[model samples]
Target: MTVPLSRPAIPVLEAGMPAPDFTLQATPDQNITLSELRGAPVVIAFYPADWSPVCGDELGLFNAALAELRRLGAQLIAISVDSAWSHTAYATQRKLHFPLLSDFEPKGEVARSYGVYRAKEGVCERALFVLDGNGIVRWAYVSPITVNPGVDGILGALEQMNNSTQQDTP
Candidate 1:
C-alpha cells in the first residue's frame, strides 16, 4: 500500500490586514518574535531557499543596508523552509547580521501561513511584507519564482510608509 502525500494549506495576508505573529528560534538559540518588534516597523522577507542566485542578491541587499534599515526604524526577518541548521550555516557563510528564521518544522508553517509556500516543491516563493508599528501590513510584494524583487521598490515603499506616519502625527 502506498501513502498519499498531503499538501500544506497556504494563508493569504491581505494589505491593511494584521500580520500573524510567531516566535521562532534564531541563531545562537535566540528567540525572535513579531510582537517583540511591534514598536517599530518591520520587513518580513520570505524566500524560496538560501544560497540561490536571486535569493542571494535579495538578501545581500538587506545585509548591505542593515544600518539604513535601522535608521528607518525598521527591523527585518527573512524566513525560509530550510532548517535552522541550514540558516545557521547560511548566516555564517554570508556574515548576516539579521536573523534568518527556520520554518522547517511542520514543514513551512510560517511560509504556508504567509501564503508563499509551494506545496509541490516544499519551498516558498519570493515574497515581501512590510508591516507598520501596529502590525498592519502596509505593503506586500510577491515575485514570480524566476524573478527577483527590486530592492529599490521595497525601499521606496518603506519611505512612503515613514512619510505617511510622519504626516499623521500631530
Candidate 2:
C-alpha cells in the first residue's frame, strides 16, 4: 500500500518581495487589478469570510481608517473566498468605502498565491500586506484565525513608508 504524500506548505510572502498581481471582481461588472494601482501604495487584506463578526469589525476598523490610509497614499482592498454578491451585500450593509474583492469561483486562488488560503477550512487566513508604490511588499503580517488584528501595525507601516518616500524625494 502506498501512503499519500501531503503537499508542502507555502510560506507567506514577506517584505522586499514583489507582490503577485491579479485581477479580482469587485462588483459583477467591475474588476480591480492589483498591477493597475502600481503608482500608489496598497494595503492588501485577506480575511476568512464575509459577514463574520471578526471580519466585520476588522473591515469596519479599516473603513474608519480610510481617510488616514488615503492620506498615507495607500489604497486598501480586502479579499475573501466569498462570492461577489456576498461581498456586495456585506459591504453595503457595513458601509465600507474600500473595495472588498471576491476570491470565489476559483475559490481562494488569490489567497493561495499570497499563501493565506486555509485549504482545510475552505477560507483565507487573516493576513495583511503593505506594498510600496512599486509593488514591493514593505510589511506583512498573519494573525490567528480568531483574533481581530487591529490597524495599528498597518498604520505604523504606512507611516514609515510615507516618511521613507518623502525622504527619498529630491
Candidate 3:
C-alpha cells in the first residue's frame, strides 16, 4: 500500500505596495527592519527552514551571487521561523554572509505579515519580495512548495526597476 503526500499552498505578496515592517532578531541579537535600509533596495527571501535541503540550495545561490546583488545596490536577507542559534549554525555551515533573520518566538509572525506563512507546515513557503529604497514593494514572486525561485529573475527585476527610476528622474 502507498499514500500520497501534500504540501501547503504558497502565499503571495502583492507588488507596488508597502512591505509590512518587522524587527526580527538576527545573529548576535542584532535587529533588522525594512525602514532602516531606506536608501537602498532590499531583497527579502522567505524560506521554509534553515537545515532543509531546498532552503540550503536557495540560500547558497544567494551567497554565491552576493557580489552581484551588492553591485546592484541591494541587500539580501533571508527569513525563517528558526531561532537565532539555528540561523547562526546554518550560516556558519553554509558560509552565507548575508543576514538570516529569525522569526522564531511568535513562530511565523513576519511570514504571516508577508503572506507567506504556511500555518499547517509551521513555516513559510519560498517567497521573494523586492522593496525599493523607500520601502515600497516593487516586485514579488511566490514559488510552489516543490519549486525553487530563479535568482537571475530577481536580479533582472531589480535591474529593471533601477533603470526605470533613473528614467523617471529626468
Candidate 4:
C-alpha cells in the first residue's frame, strides 16, 4: 500500500509584499516578463478560464476600463491556465487591449506563485493584484469563484498609490 502525498495550500499574497516575477506567453511568438514592466504600476487579474461567462465579463469590464486604468498609470494584464493559442483567440474575439498571458505550460505556475492557484479546480481563483512601480504589491483581492471582481477596487488602489506618491514627494 502506498500513501498519496498531499500538496500544501498556498497562502494568498497580500499587500506590501513584493510581487512575484514571471514570464508568460502573451501570444504564440511573444512573451511578457513581469520584471520588464517595472517603473509603471501593474494590474494583474487572474481568472479561472479564458472564455467562461464570468471570466469573459470580468475581462470585458477591464477592457472597457483601459483608458481609466491608463490614466492611473497602470498597465493591466490578465492571466489564466489557458494555452497561448486559446488566449490569442479569446483576446481577439473579445477585442481586449491588454495582454492575456498564458499560464498553461506548467499549468498555473504564475497563479501558484501569486497564491491564487486552485488545485482541485485546475484553474486560478478570481484574484487581482495592484503592484506599484517598484513591483511591491499595493493591494490584493480574491473574489469567490463565481464572482466577477469589477474594476473599482483596482482603480481605487491605483489612486491611493498615486496619492501616496505625491505625498511622499518633497
Candidate 2 local distance difference test against the native: 0.91
Show the lowest summed lDDT stretch of 10 residues, model 3. Answer: 2-11
Whole-model lDDT values for every prediction: 0.84, 0.91, 0.86, 0.92
- Residue 31 shift from truth in candidate 1, angstroms: 2.0
User: Lowest-lDDT window of 10 residues in candidate 2?
Assistant: 2-11
List of clashing residue pairs for candidate 4: none
Tens digits of per-residue lDDT for model 3 on 1-170?
85543344434668888988889988766888778888999999999888888888899999999999998999999999999999998999999999999999899888888888888779887889889988888888888866778698789878998899889996
TM per candidate = 0.90, 0.94, 0.92, 0.94
lDDT of 1 by residue, 31-109 (tens): 6888988988899998889889888888988899888788888898999988788899998998888999888788888
* Backbone Cα, N, C clashes tallied per candidate: 0, 0, 0, 0
lDDT assessment of candidate 4: 0.92
Residue 125 in model 3: lDDT: 76
| Candidate 3 RMSD computed on C-alpha atoms after optimal superposition onto the true structure | 2.4
Runs in model 2 with CA error above 4 Å?
1-8
**26-88: candidate 2 lDDT, tens digit per residue:** 998899999999999999999999989999999999999999999888999999989999999
Number of the top candidate by lDDT?
A: 4
Which structure is stronger by TM-score: 1 or 3? 3
lDDT of 3: 0.86
Candidate 2 colliding pairs, count: 0
- Model 1 stretches astray by more than 4 angstroms: 1-11
**Per-residue lDDT of candidate 4, residues 102-159 (tens digit):** 9997988899999898887789889999999999999999998889989999999999
